[model samples]
Target chain A: MPEQTDRTENPEHTLVEVRGFRMAYGATTVIDRLDFEVVRGETFGLLGSNGSGKTTTLRALLGLIVPTAGELTIGGEPYRPGRVRVGYLPEERGLYKREPVLEVMTYFGRLKGMTAGDADRWSRSWLERMGLADKARLALGKLSGGQQQKVQLGVTIMDDPELLILDEPTKGFDPVNQRLLMDIIAEQQRRGTTLVLVSHDMAQVERLADRVLLLKDGVARAYGSVADVRGEFGGKSLNEVFLEVYGTVGLEEDAA
Target chain B: MSAFGIVLRFEVARALRKKAFWIGALALPVIIGVIGLVQFLGAQSAQQAAEEQAKAGFEFVYLDASGVVDARLATELGGAPAADADSAIAQVRSGETEAFFDFPADPSTQPVTIAGRHVGVIDDGRYGAVATTLLAESAKTEIGSPELVAIVAGGVRTDVTTYLPDGSVSTAAQSLPVGILLLALLFLTVVLLGQQVLIVTTEEKENRVAEILLTTTRPNAVIAAKLVALAIAGVVQMLVVFVPVAIGWALFGGGLSIAGLDLSQVVFDPQQILLGVLILLGAAALFIVTLAAVGASAPSAKEAGGFSALSIILPLAPLYAAAIIVTQPSLPIVRVLTYFPFTAGTTSLLRNAFGTLPLVEGLLVAAILFVSAALVLRIAVRAFRRGALEYDRMLGWRDLLGRPAR
Candidate 1:
C-alpha cells in the first residue's frame, strides 16, 4: 500500500514534523533517519514493543533529549520552551505522589498559561468528571494505581491542550474506566485536538488510531492507516500483526 | 504569567507548605531562645548566690606548683590553702571552698582556668579584682613592677571607641551587634538556602516529574526559579529570626559580665563592613548554583545528601576559621580560601566582617565567586536536562561535564 500522506510537506496543518531525524547518544543511535508527522486534528498511533524507540522519538521531539541531526518543528517553529500548548503523559506515571492531586493539576494548568482561577476552576470540574472529586484533597500516593491514573488524566487534559502525547493512558485502568478514558481521549481529538498515542495494546489503537506507525529497532516497519497496515500484513488483526512484526523485527535487530 | 514565574511560584509554595522547611528555619531561634531562657534563669540563681557569698566571703583552695602567686593569694584574699589540686576540687564540690585556681603547669604555654563553687557575677567580679591586686603586689615585690605588665593586668580603662566609615566615633558596643548580625546572616543563608536548593532541585528527579516539567519549561528556567524561590524563602526566614534575636540580644546584653572576648569590635572596622557585604552577596550566589549542580547530577535525594554536606561544610569552614583569619590574616591558606569557589564567600564574609580582609582584595574574590555561580548554573541546567531520566544509576562529576549519559 502507498504510505499514508505525511502532512510535514504542507507544514500548514502539521502540528509536529520530523524530517530525516537522527538521534544518537555517543556511538549508540536510538533513532536513525526516522521520519514522521503528527498533523492537526489527527489521532496518530506510534506502536512498538519496549525499547523500540517510540518513547525515544517522543522524547526527542519534546526536546528532552537533544537530537543529533534533524529538522524538527512544533507549530512550525523550532523546539523552544513553551512554544505551544503541548501536554504529555509519560508511560511511567510521573506525578509527584506526595503532592495533592489538585495541586499537581493546577501547577501544570498554570504552566500551560491558564490563570490561577481558571486553572483551579477547570481542574475541579475535571476531577469531578473523572469521579475523583473526593480524592482531590488527598495525596496521589493515597490513591490506588487505577485512581492515580485517573487523576493524571485530569492533569493532562485540565488545560484542554491543542496537542497531546499520551503513553499507554489506559495502562492500569479496569475495563470500564479504560473504555471511559478512551472515549474521553477520542472526544478530545474530535474537538480539533491532535494526539500522538503510544500504546502496546494494538486492539485499542486499531480502534482509536486514524493512522499508525509500527517501528522496529528505531526504523518504521509499517506506516499507514490502521486498515491499510492490516491489509498489508495479510489482513491479520492487530494482535496477530504485532506478533508477526515483532517476530521478524527481533531477527532483524539480532542480525544488525 | 511566564513559565519562569510559574516554576518559581511553585517552588516557593511547595517550600512554604513543607513542615520540615519551617522546622529547619525556626530550629536555630528556638534553640537560641532556650539558651537565653537558661541564661536568664542562671542570672537569677547567681544573684541569689551572690548575696549569700557577701556574708561568707571567698575561700581559695589551691595547688600552685609556682609558690609565689598562691602564697600571695591566700593572705590577700584570706582563703584556706589545700594540700593538692584533687582535695581542693573535692572541697569546692562539697561547698567547702569557693574556688580552686589551678595555675598553669607550664605557666607560659598552658592555660590557667578558675574553678568556682556556686559561682556568680559577684564571685566573678571579686575573683578578677582579687587576682589583679595580689598579682600586682607580687610583681612590685618580686619583679619590681614591670610597668607594661602592671598597666595591662590592672584592667586600665579605655575610651572603647570605634571610628566610623562616616568619620564619626561611636561606642564599641554598637558595632558588636551590627557585625554579629551580618555574620550570622551569611552563615544561615549559605547553609539554609543551600539545603533548599538541593532539596528542590533533586525532588523533581526523585518524583520523576522532570520529564513533564522539562517539556513545558526550560531546564534553566526550572533551575533559576528554584534558586530564586529558595532565596526569597531564605531572606524571609532570616528576617523572622533576626528581628527577634537581635532585639533580645540588644535588650538583655548590656552590663552582663560575660567571660568571652567582646565581638563589638570584631566587625567594628569600617573597611570590613563594606567588604563583608560584598562577600555575603557573592557567596550566596556561588552556593546556590553549585548546590543546584550537585543536585542535578545526583540520582536521588540520598545521593544528593553527601554533596549537600560538602556544600554546607565548605562555606561554614571559613566561619570556623575566624580566629586564624582575624589574628593572622596574611596566611597563605586564608588567602587561598578567600579565592576558592566553595570557601570564597564565607571566608571573605567572615574575615571581612571581623575586620581582617581588605576592601580591594575582598571585592576581587567576590567577583570571582559571582562569575563561578553563573558558570555553575549553566552547567547545572545542562546536567539536569541530560541526567533527569538516568535515575536508575548514579550521575557523577563526569556526567556534569559534557559527557552524555549512556
Candidate 2:
C-alpha cells in the first residue's frame, strides 16, 4: 500500500461529505447514520461486502436517490448536473447496447456538457486509447464483456469530469487490461480529479486509494488513510483486514 | 444544446435508426396502396362490362294490355312491341330475345309481369329496373304535358337543415366525414406513436442505463426530453402515412367520391377542426407522459409490454362505444369517457365532429388531459428515481409512495 498523508485535519480539503445519512426501505433500514468524507485530489476506496450499502451510499451521494434523513453532498453542495461535472460508472454495468459505441459515448459526452463536435472528437480519442477504435461503430452488445466495460469507462471519463465515481470499474477486465485501467485512473488522479472507487478487489483498492472506508451493513467499520487502517487492524494487508471485517460469510458470498 | 435538447436529439436519432420503426412506418401505407389499386381495377372492370352490356341492347318486347304503352320510348330504352305475351315468353325461353314484359289491364290493381333469361341472382335485378323505367316513361308520355310529366317522373326532393340547441345550423351529412376523419387521425397518432413512446421509455430501465442517466442530468429533464422526442417522432410517422394519402386523395378523390356523400353539400366547420387540433395536442401529451410513467414503474421492457398494450387499448375504448358517442352524447358513459384522461381525446374528437360538444365542454376536456399530463410527468420523474437501480422487482405502490434516499 502506498503511504498517503492524513488530511482530516482540514475541512477545506474535503471534496465529498456525508453526515448522519440514513436510508430505510419500509420497515427495514439499509443504512443508519453513516458518515465519511473524501478529500480533493485523493483516490477514495469505498469497500464493503455484498449488500453492505456501498452502492446505496454512492447512490445517495450522487443524488440518484433522495436520502431519508441526512445530507450527502459533493463539493459542499448537493450533486446536480452542470453544478459540477460528474462522471458515474454504476455497478449494474450497462449502456444502450443496440447503439454504436461511438454514438453511445458521444451521447453521454454531450449530456456531460460537451459540444457535439468536441464530444465526437473526445469519444473517438477515448476509443483509440482503449484499443477499441475498430469497434466504435459496432453495436455495444456485439463486443466482449470487457470491451463493453472499457467503452463505458471511456464514456464516464471522456469529458474530464471533476469528480468520478466508479463502482467496480475493473469488474470484467483481464489482468493486463486491469493494469491498463489503473494507469488510466492514475492519470485522472494526477489531473486533480477526486475519485470514489467501490470494488471487492482489495489489492486494487490498496494500490490506488489514498484513503479507504470499509462499510459493513451500512456502518463505517474502518476509515482514514490506508496505512492507518492497516495499522489499526494489526498491521495486515487490506485483503486480510477485509476478511476480518466481513468474516467467512464474505468469502462465501465473494466466491459465489 | 441544453441537456433536454441533447437527450431529445439522441432519443429521436435512436428511434429513427431502428429498422423496425422504418418497416412499421412504411408497412401500413404500402398495404393501403395495394388494396386501393385492386379495388380501382375491379371498379374499372365492372364499368367496362356494364358499358358493353348497354351497347348490346336487351331486345325485349312488351304487350301493354292497359293501352298506355309508348312504343317510341320503349324502342329508345331497348325494348320493342311483342305481338302477344305467349310468343314473347317463347322467344325469351328460346334465347331469341332477352326478355318479355306484359302490362296488366288494371296496372294499379294487378302487377306487371316480366320473363327474362336466367342470369345471376344480382344481375336479374337489372331486368326489373329496366322494366320499371320503361313503364314510368310510358306513363309520363300518357300524361302528355311536359310539366306534369316532369313532376310525375321524379318524386319531391327535400333538403333538411337542423337548428341545434347551441344556435348552430348543420346538416347530419356535414358532420359524418369530419367524425370519420378525426377517428382515423386519433388511431394513427396515438396507437402508432404510443408504441414508440413505451419502447423509448422502458429501454433505459431494461438496459440499466437510467441510473447513469440520472447522475448525468436531472431525472425530470430526462423524462421530459424523452416525452418531447417521442411526440416529435410520432408526428414524423404520421406525416409518412398521411402525406401520401392526402396527395392521393387530392389527385384521384374526385373520381372516387364516397357514394352517399355529395361533396357540394358537405360543409366543413373551422371551429370544429380547430377544437379537434387542440384535443389532438392534449391527447398526445397525456398519453406520452402516462406511457413514460408506466415505463419507469416497470421492472423491465418485457414487463412494460403489457402496460403498453393497455395504454393503447384504453384510448381506443371510446371507439367501441361509438354508438353511445354518436347517438347519446349526453349519456353518463359518454361523460365518463370524455373526462377520463386516457379516453378524453377520442371522445372529445367524436363529440366535436358531431357538434355535440360545446366550446366550454371541449375546453374542459382538453384541460383535463393537460392537467393530467402535468401530474403524470411528476409521477414519471419520481418513479424513475425510485426504480432506477431496481433490476429484478417492479416498483409497486409502496415503493412509489415511499420516497427514496437522497
Candidate 3:
C-alpha cells in the first residue's frame, strides 16, 4: 500500500504507472514492455492499429489480466489482481439483457462498494443525465444500442472510481450521443478522475487526451503530449501521424 | 458491504430480472401442477371404473374331479352356487364367470393337476390342505373303526404343521417395494432439478451474460445466488409433484380402500429427508461449479452446449443406476460411485432412503461431496476471473488446466 499524493504539487502526476509491461498469449506477444502513465485529472488516449494491443493494455491496467512481466501501480499502490479500485468498460458490448437500467447500474455500483441508497440515487442522476430516465425500468435489451452504451457509462461512474478505463466508449454513438459521452468524460475529468480512453477516432482523442501513446507491433512507437506527437509528424493530424507510422507497414504486409 | 456480499446482491438482482429465471422458477411449478392434476384425474377415473366393474358379481366355477366334494362345495365357496358341475363349467367357458378352479380326483398323488379356465393353477399349498380335509372326511364315513380313524387323523396332523412365523415378517417384506418406489421418486426429482441448474448456468454463459456478471461481481457470489434460487425452485417443483399425489391418496379413502397402497412402515424419516436435501444442495453446487467452469471455458454458447451435455449425463446416469445399486450397495461399481461427488449425492441419498446406508458411511459420503463442492466453487471462481480478463482469447480448457507459465 502507498499514500495518495496531492494532485496540486504535480499537475502531470502519474495516477496510473505501467513500466516495462509485457503480455503474451502462448506464442503471440500482445503487449511488449509498454511504458506509460495516466496523469491525475487528465484523459489519456491509447491509440493503436487493429492488433496494436490497446484493449490488452487497458485490460492489464485494470488488473483483469496479470502481465507476463512488469509493474503496474494506481495512485501509488501496486495493482492487486482482484481488488484494484478501478472501473472498466470492455470493448465488447455486453449487459444483462434481462436486467432493467436502474437495477443493472445499481448492481455494478454495489460491486464497487457503494451503499444501496447512494447507488440508487447516483444511478438515477446518471440515467437522467444520459436522457435514459424514461427507460429506467425497461430491460437493457429493450434499449437501443446507443442507449445501452449510455447505461454502460453510467455503470462505470456510479461507484465514482478513481480510475475509469473505457475501451472505445463512443464506438456506436451518434454525434449527439458522442457529444453527450464526451461531456460526461469532461465532467469526470473535472472531478479529478483519471481516465484512460482507448479509441481509433483520432479527432476525439486529440480533443480529449492530454497525452497520447501510439502502440504498434506490441511496442510503443510514439509517446508524448498530443501536440508534441502531432508536431513531430510534420504538423499532421493524429490520423495522418498514425498512417505515417503504421500505414505503410500494414499496407506492405497486406500487399505481400 | 463486503466484496462477496456485493457480488451476491448483484447476482441475485441480475438473476431475478431474467425472464428465463422467473419462467424456470415460477412457471415450471405451474406446468408441473397441471401435468400432475391431469394424471391424478385420469388415475381417479380409472380406479372408479375398476371398482364399479368389480362390484358387478363375477360368476366363478370350479371342477371337483375328486368327486368326494359335490355341489355343496360350491355353496361353501360363498358365491351364487351353480345347479351342478356341468352348469358351473359351462358358465366359466361362456365368460359369464371371471374365473374357475378344478381339483384333481386323486388326492394322494404328487404334483396333482389343478386347472383354471383362463390359466394354469399351481398348487398354493392351501388347496392341498383343503383336498386332504375333504378326502379325510369322506374316508371317515366309509371306514367306521375308532382305531383306524385315530391313525388317519394322526397322519393328517403330521402332514400339516404350523411352522409359519406369525405375521410381522410378511408385512415388512410387503412394504419393501413402497420404500424402493419412494427412493426412485427422490432420485428422479434430484436428477431433473439438478439438470435444470446446469442448463441455466450454461445458457447464461453461452449468451455472455455471465461475463457481464463476472466483471461486476465475484464468481463465488454468483454461484451462491444461483444455487439458492435454483434450490428453492427445485423444492417447489418437488412439492408440486408430491403434495397433490399425497392429497389425492388421502382423499381416496385414506389408504385403506386402495389395494396397492402400503403404509405399514416408514418410507422417509426426518433424518433421511434432511440428508436428501443436503445431498440435493451438494449436487446442485457441483452442477453449478461444473457448468460454470464449462461455460467459462467455452468460446461461445454453441460450444458450451457440447460441454454442458457431460454435466447433464453424469448425474443422471447414477440416478438411473440407483435401482440396481440399491439392492447391492456394496458392489464395487456402486461403492465407487457412492464416493464420487456428483453421483454420490443422488445415489447415496437414495441408498439412505432404502436403509442400505450405514450412518458413518452416509456422513463420510456427505462430507466428501461437500468438499468436492467447495473445490468446484474455487475452480469456477478462477475460471470466471481468467475468462473475464481475457476477452480476445476465446476461453478454453487451457485457461483452467494450463495457465501461462508466469
Candidate 4:
C-alpha cells in the first residue's frame, strides 16, 4: 500500500474520506486497501472501467455495504442517512415504474426528509425544468428510457442535498440532454455541494473533476488533481491516460 | 412524520390503491353470499311448490286389516274406507285413487304398504311422512293420555350434564364447534394474507426502491413499518369480507345451522375466547415477521412465494391431526403442536375450545407463542437488515446469521 498525500490536510475541508478501506465478499476482495478524500465544494471523478470496484467503493462510503477492514466516513463521521444531506444516483437506474412520475419523485423526496408539500412543489418544478411537465401524472414506465433517466437524476438532486454521488448520471442520454445534465451537476458543484461523479466519459470527468482517482483492479492507479494525474502519466489527455492504464482489455469490458 | 410512519403509510396506501387488493379482499364474502342466496331461494321455491300441492288436495283410500285406523281420522286426512283389498287395488290401478295405504294386521311389526301413482322421487317422500303422522295421531287417540302418546312419538331430547372430577359442568361437546370455528378463522386469515405478507419486502427490492429507502431510514425501522403495515392491510381486507357476512347473518340466517350444530346453544366462554385471541395475535405476528424475512431473503417476489407457502402451511398443518388434538389433547403429538410456535395457535385454540385445555396450560401456551414470536421477530429483523440489498441471489443461512462474509 502506498501512502497518498491529501490535497487538503485540514479535516474541516474534507467532506468525504476513506482511509485504508477494504471490502470483501466470501474471500473475494472487491476493494483492497485504498485511500482518498473529497474536499468540500469540489467534483471528484471516481474513474474506473466496469467491475473495477467504483460502485462498490461508493456503496461502502455511503454505508450501504460494510467495509471489511477500514474507515469510510462522510462529514467526519460514518455515513448515517439524515445525519448529513446526501443524494445518490445508483448505476442501476430504477424507480416505481407503476407509480406516477410526480408521486414517485415526491415519495423519494419525503424519504429524503422533505415535507410533503415541499417535496411536491420541488418535484413539479423539477419536472418543468427538465421539460417533463407533461409527464407528472403518467406512470414512470410510460416514459422513454432517456426520460426515465432524467427523472432519476431529478429524484437524486430534488432535495438540494449537500453531497451528491452520481454513478453514470449521463448514461443513455443524447448529446443535448447530456449537456443539460452536466450543466445541472455543475450548478450543484457551484452551490458548494461536494460531488462524486462516476462515469466512463473521460472528457466529462476531465472537464468537471477538480481531483480524480483512477482505479484499476480495486487499487488506485492514479490519484490527486486532474493536472497532476495527467502530468504523472506524461502530460497525456485523461482519455489517453485511461487507455494507457487499462489498455484494450478495459475497452472490451466497457463495451460488454 | 418519522421515517417509520412514512414507510408504513406508503405501503398501506399503496396496497389500498391497487385494484387487485380490493378484488381479493371482496372475493370470499361475495362467493359465500352468492352461495347462501342460491340456497335460500331454492328453499323458498321448494316450499312454495309444496304449499301449492297441499292446496290442490290429495285423495286416498285405506284398507286397514289391523283395525287400528280410526274412521274419523281417515276422513280428516282425505282418505275413504275401502271395502276390500281387491277394490283398493282396482281403484289405485285405474288411477281413480291418488294413493292407497294398507295397514297390516300387526302395524308395528309389519310394514304399511303404499300403492300410489308415480310421483317424482323427492315428492314420494311426502307419502311416507304423512302415513307416519297418521299412525301417530291414531295411537294418541287410542291411548287417551297425552303423556303416553308423547312418549310413544320418539320426540325425547336428553340434555346430559356430566360433572368433572372437580364438579364443574363439562362443556366439551358445546365448545367443540367453537374451537373448530376459531381454528378455521385462523387458517382463513393466514391464507388470505400470505401472498401480501410475502411481497411486502420483495416489492421494494424488485422495483429497486430498497436502496433509496435504506439510504434514508434505518433498515429495522423500514422492516418493522412494513410488517405493521401488512397487518393493517390484512385487517382491512378481513373487515371488507366480514362486514357483508355479518349483514347477511342479520338478514337471512334464520334456521341456518352447520352440520346440525345449533349455534344458538354454543356457550360463549369469556376466558376461553380471550385465550384464543391472545394465541391468535402471537401466531399472526410470528407469521408476518417470518414471511417478511423470507421476502427480504429472496431476490424476487415470485421466489418468496415458495417459502411463504411453507410458512402458511405450518399453522394449518396441525389441522390434519385435529382428531387427535381434540380426542386426546394430552397426547405427545398434540402437546408438541400446542407448544410449537407455528402450530401452537391452532392446537391451543382447539384444545381450549373443546374444554380439554386446562387454564394454566392454556396460559402457558399463549406465553410460549408470544415469547417465540418475539424471538423470531428479532431474527427476522436482523436477517432483513443483512439481506435487504441482496437483489441477485437468495440469502443463505450463513448470511442470515450475520456471520462475516467468507
Candidate 5:
C-alpha cells in the first residue's frame, strides 16, 4: 500500500484518514489496501467508473462497512457513528415516498441529532432556498424526479454537517438545477464543510474538487491535485484524462 | 433525544399517519363492536317479541277445587287458586282468563279437567306441560319423602377430574374457550404487530432509506427501534380491537352460563398460563424478527407483500390442526407444531388451555422457543446490517447461506 501525504496549508486539518484499508465480501476484495485522505474544508472527488468500488470505499469511510484490515479515522478519532456531525446522500436516491417533502427532510435531520423544531426550521429554510417551499407538503412520490433530487440534497445539507458525502447527488437534475446544485455545494465548501463528492462526472469533479483520487478496479489509478492529474495526462481536461486512463484498460481486457 | 428514540418515534409516527394503518388497526374492533351491538339488540328484540306474543296468547288460570292442593300447586305454577271454577269459566268467556285448569273432585289418581275457549290460543300441548309439572308436584307432596325428593329433583353433582398416565390429575372444569382465546391473542399479535415489522422493514429496503440510516445509526439500533415501534403499535391496535369486545363480553356474557355449570368452579394451572405467555412472547419475537429479515431481503414492497402473506400463513397453519389436537392431544404432528418456535405459541397455548400439554413438556418447549427467538433476533440484526446498502437487489441465497455471492 502507498503512504498518504499530509499537506500543511489547511487550517481545519484532516477530517478523514485511511491507511492500508482493505475491504472484501467473502472472497471478493472490493477495495484492496487503498490509502487516501480527505482534508477539512476541501472537496475530495472519489472518481471511478461503475463497479469500481467507489460506493464501497465511502461506506467503509463512514463505518457502514467494516474494513477487512486497516486503520480508518474520522475527525481525528476511530470512526464511531453519531460521534461526528456527518451527512450522506446515497447513490440510489430515496426518501419516505409517503412522507411529505419537508417531513422527510426533517426526519433525516433529526436522526443526525437536530431537535424537531430546529430540524423543522432548517428543513423549511432549505426547501425555500432550493425553490421547493411550495411543494413542502406534497408527498415525495408526487414530486418530479428532479424535485426529489433537490429534496434529497436538502436532506443531506440541511443539518450543516461538518463532513458531508454525496453519491450521485446530481443524478436526475436538469442543466439549470445541476449548475444551481453545484454552486450550492461550492458555497457549502466555502463554509469549511469537508465534502466527499463521488460521481462519474469528471467535469463536475474537475470544477469542484480541490484534490482527487481516481480508482480503477478498486486500486488507485491516479492520486494528486487536479492540475497534477491534468499534467500527468498531457495537459488534457480531467474528462479526457479519465478517458485516457480507462480507454487503455478496455482495449487490454478485450485483447486478453 | 437518543438516536434510537428518534428512530422509534419517527417510524411509529410515519406508520400511524398512513390511512392503511388506521383502517387495519380499526377494522377488527369496529367489526367486533358491530357484532356486539347486533347481539345486544337481537336479544332485546327477542325478549320484547316474546312478551308481545304472550300478551296475545293464552295464559293459564288455575281453578283448584281440592283444598289440600289449592295453595302449593298454584304458588308453584306462578299463579293463585281461583275462588270459583264457575267464575274462571266466566272469566275465560269474557277474555279475562284465556284458559282454566280445573282440579279433580278428589285427590285420587284421577286426572284434572282443563276447559278453555276454543281458539288458536287454547293449544292443549302448552297447558299439558303445565299440568304435568303441577301433577308431579302433587304426587311428590302426596307420596315422596324429603330425601327422595332431593334425590329425584336434584341428582348427583359430579366434577370431572382426569388422572393422567403420570398419575397427576387435571381439572376439566375450565372452559375450552380460554385456549381458543390465547390462540386468538397470539395471532392477533402477529397480524397486528409482526406484519407491521415486515412493512416497515420492507419500506426501508424499498425506499433505500436504510442507506442513509445505516450511516447515522447502527444497524442493530435500527432493528431494535423498529421492533419497539411495532410492538407499541401492536399493543395499541390490540387494545383498540379487544377493549370493546371485552367490555361487551363482560356486559352481556356474564350470564352466559351453561346449565349446572359454575364459572367460579373452573381452575387452571398457573404453570400452564405462564407457559402460554412464554410461548406467545417467543413466537412474537421469532415471527416479527424473521419477517423483518425477509422484508429486508426483498427488493421491493410488492415482493415483500407476497412474503408477508407467507409469514402470516406459516404461523397460522397450526391453528387448522385444532380438531386433531382436541382428541389426540400431543399427537406427533400436534407435538411437532407445539415445540417449533414459529408454530409453538398458538399451538402450545391451545394445548395448555385444553390441559393437553403436560407442565414439564410445555416448559421445555417454551424454553426452546425462547432461546430460538433470541437467536433469530441476533441473526436478524446481522442480516439488517449486511443488507443495508444492497439496494435494487436481493440477498442472494449464497450470501444468505453464509457463502460468497460472487
Candidate 6:
C-alpha cells in the first residue's frame, strides 16, 4: 500500500500546504490569510510570541481545529481527523500518572494503527534509546518529569508519523533533556518526517528550523527561510525580530 | 494483540497502579465481615443471659370464672401450684407474676386471654407453648364433636413440621448478604471506574493531552479505550470480592444454602444473568461516555465535576425504586428505567436476580441499553476531540449540528 501510494504521488516534495487560511473565535481573528508549505523531511518552526496563533495554525494543519476560512492539505490529500498522518505534542505536559511507561507508549502506538506486538517492540526500543529500559515497569508518575517527557515524545514518534506537530517541546526540560529532544527531532527529520515546531525559544528555533514564519496579531509578519527572515530584520536575533513584529508592551506594561 | 486488547491492557494497567483503586476495592467486604461477626456474638450472649435470668421461679395467676373442677389446670400453668387466686392476682397486679391467665365461666363463648406487663422482656418459649395448648383445648370443646375431638386431641400430640416448596426461605437468607455485597461491589466499582474517565478527561483538558492524542488517533478510539479499560477494572474488582466470598461460603459450610430454598422459581436464570451483565456494561459505558463528554465540554476539572456528578447520581434512582421494582418489574417507571441506558444496568441486574424479568422483555431492555451506549460513545468521542484541539473554546448544540470536524 505504501509503495503504490508513494509511486502515484510526488513523495520527494511538499507534504503540507496551507493557502489563504483564516481562523477566528467569534470576532477575534487568530490566523488571517496565512499561506505556507512544509516540504517533505524538513524541520519547520512556527515562531511567535504568546497568543500569536502559532498553536492555532499548527492545529489547523493537523485538522484539529478547522480554519474559519482556508485550504489545508496533508500528503496530497485533504486533512481529515483520522486520515491525516500527524503526531502532536501539545503545549501542556500530560501522562497517565498510574500507567507503566512501556504500557502507555504501546497503547498510543496501537491507537495509531500498529498491532500490539509491533507497538510493544517499538516501545521497547524507544525506551532503550531514551535510557528508560530499566524504568519501563515503573509508573509514569514515579519517573522524573524529564523522563516522562521522553516517554511522551516516544509515543509521538513511535508510529513513524508522516507529520509531527510539537508545541513548546522543551518548555519544562533542563538543558540535557532539551538536547535529547533535539536529537530525537533531528532523527525524525532524517527519517523523512515533516515537523512543525511551535516554540518561543529563539536559539532552538534558529538552529533547527529550515523555514520560519513569524505570526503576530493573527497575521504572518514574516514568512520565509530562517536565514531570509533573520536577514530581513538586519542581523537581529529571532527573539528581537519577534518582539519587533508583535509589540511586547501589553502584558508587562499593564503589570508595571 | 488486537486493537481492543491493546487498549484494554493499557487501561487495566493504569487503573491498577492507582492507590485509590485498591483501597476502594477491598475495604467494604472486610468491614462487612467484621460487622457480621460482632452482631452474631452479641446475639448469642443476649440469649445466654436471658436463660440465666429465667432460673428465678416465675409467679402465675389464674382468673377462672368458669370454676372448673380440674386441679391439674393450675399445676399445668406453673411449675408449682399457686397458694390462692387472690394472692396470685395481687402478685400479678403488682407485676410480680410473669403472666395471668383468665378463663371465663362460659369458655364456649370467649377464648382464653393471657395478660402480662413484661411478656416479651424475656424469652418465655415454655410459657407460650402452654398457653397455645390450653387455647386449642378450649377450641376443641366449642366444636362439640366426639370424632373431631379425637382428631383435635391427636393433633396436640403430633409434632408440627414446616416445609418450603420453593426453597426460598433459605435462598432469601443467602441472597440477602450476596445481594447487598453485589450492590456495594458494583457501586464502588462504578464510582472508581467512572472517576478514572472523569479524571483522565479533566487532566487532558487541563494539561492539553487530548490535543496531542487527537492528532494521531481518532477521538472515538480514545474514548472507547477509556470506557473499556474502566469497565475491565470494575469487573476485576468485582471478581476479587465476589470470588473469595463465594468460595468461602461454598467451602466453609457458610456458603449460600439452597437446601430449603426453591431456587427453581428464582427469576435470574443464566440467560437473565447474561442480559443483566450486558445491560450493566451498557449502562456503565453510557455513564462514562456522558461524563467524559461533559468533562471535555467543560473548561476545567472543577467545572467538569458538576457535570460528572449528574452521571454519578442518576443510577442511584434505580436503587431507591428497588422495592417497587421487585413487586412490579413491569411498572412504567421500572420499564422506563430498564430501557434507559443509565438506570437499565443496575435495575435490570436486580430484576434478573429476583427472577422478575420475562424473556422477551429482557432482550428488548438489553438492546435499548446497548444502542444507547453506542450513540453516547459516538457523541462523547466527537466532543472530546473537538474540545481538546480547539483551544479555549466551548461546544454548544449548534456546533454539534454544524459541519463535522475535519
Best by TM-score: 4
- The segments of candidate 4 whose C-alpha lies over 4 angstroms from its true place after superposition are A1-3, A131-138, A174-177, A248-256, B39-165, B168-181, B245-266, B404-406
lDDT, residue B397, model 5? 52
Against the hidden reference, what TM-scores do the models get?
A: 0.80, 0.81, 0.73, 0.82, 0.75, 0.72
Evaluation by TM-score, superior candidate among 2 and 4: 4
Q: Regarding TM-score, does 2 or 3 come out ahead? A: 2
Best candidate per DockQ, number? Answer: 2
lDDT of 3 by residue, B1-406 (tens): 7665665555555545555655655565577678988988999976665444334333455555666554554444423434566666667677776444455666557333332244323323333334344445556756778778888777433222222255322222333445455445545454545445545455444444543455455566666666566555656556655676678767763354334444533344555555655666666667666776766565555656677787767767786786777788989999988998768866786686666777678778768877898887666666666765443455656677665321
lDDT of model 5 at residue A63?
A: 74
Per residue, candidate 1 scores C-alpha lDDT tens digits across A102-216 of 8888998888778899988898898888788998878788998777777777777777788899987777778877877878887897798999999998988998888888877
Error of 4 at A85 (Å): 0.8
Tens digits of per-residue lDDT for model 1 on B170-224? 4445444555656777778876676677777788888878888887777777888
Of 3 and 6, the candidate ranking higher by lDDT = 6
Q: On a 0 to 100 scale, what is the lDDT of residue B242 in model 5?
A: 77
Q: Judging by TM-score, tell me the better candidate of 3 and 5.
A: 5
Docking class of 2: medium
lDDT (CA) for every model shown? 0.76, 0.82, 0.67, 0.82, 0.76, 0.71
Q: In every candidate, how many clashes are there? A: 1, 5, 3, 2, 0, 11
lDDT of 4 at B24: 87
The TM-score of predicted model 5 comes to 0.75
User: Per-residue lDDT for B270 in model 1?
Assistant: 62
Q: What is the interface RMSD of each candidate, in Å?
A: 3.3, 1.7, 4.0, 3.3, 4.1, 2.6
The runs of at least 3 residues in candidate 2 whose Cα sits more than 4 Å from the true structure, single-residue gaps closed, are A1-9, A248-256, B39-172, B249-256, B264-266, B404-406
lDDT of 1: 0.76
Ranking by lDDT: 2, 4, 5, 1, 6, 3
lDDT of 5 by residue, B1-406 (tens): 8888888888788877888778988987787779989988999986675444433444667765664453565565555566688887788789887678877757467677776666555344456556555666776786659778877777657756777678977564364555556678888887677656767777777787787878777777788888888887777777878777677667866555545555445455566667777777777777887788777777765666776777678788876887887678747898788777777777777777877777788788878877987777766676676676676676655545563211
In model 5 chain B, which range of ten residues has the least summed lDDT? B397-406
Off by over 4 Å in 6: A1-12, A79-87, A109-133, A158-162, A183-193, A248-256, B1-3, B16-25, B56-193, B196-208, B244-285, B295-305, B319-362, B389-403
Which is superior by TM-score, 1 or 6? Answer: 1
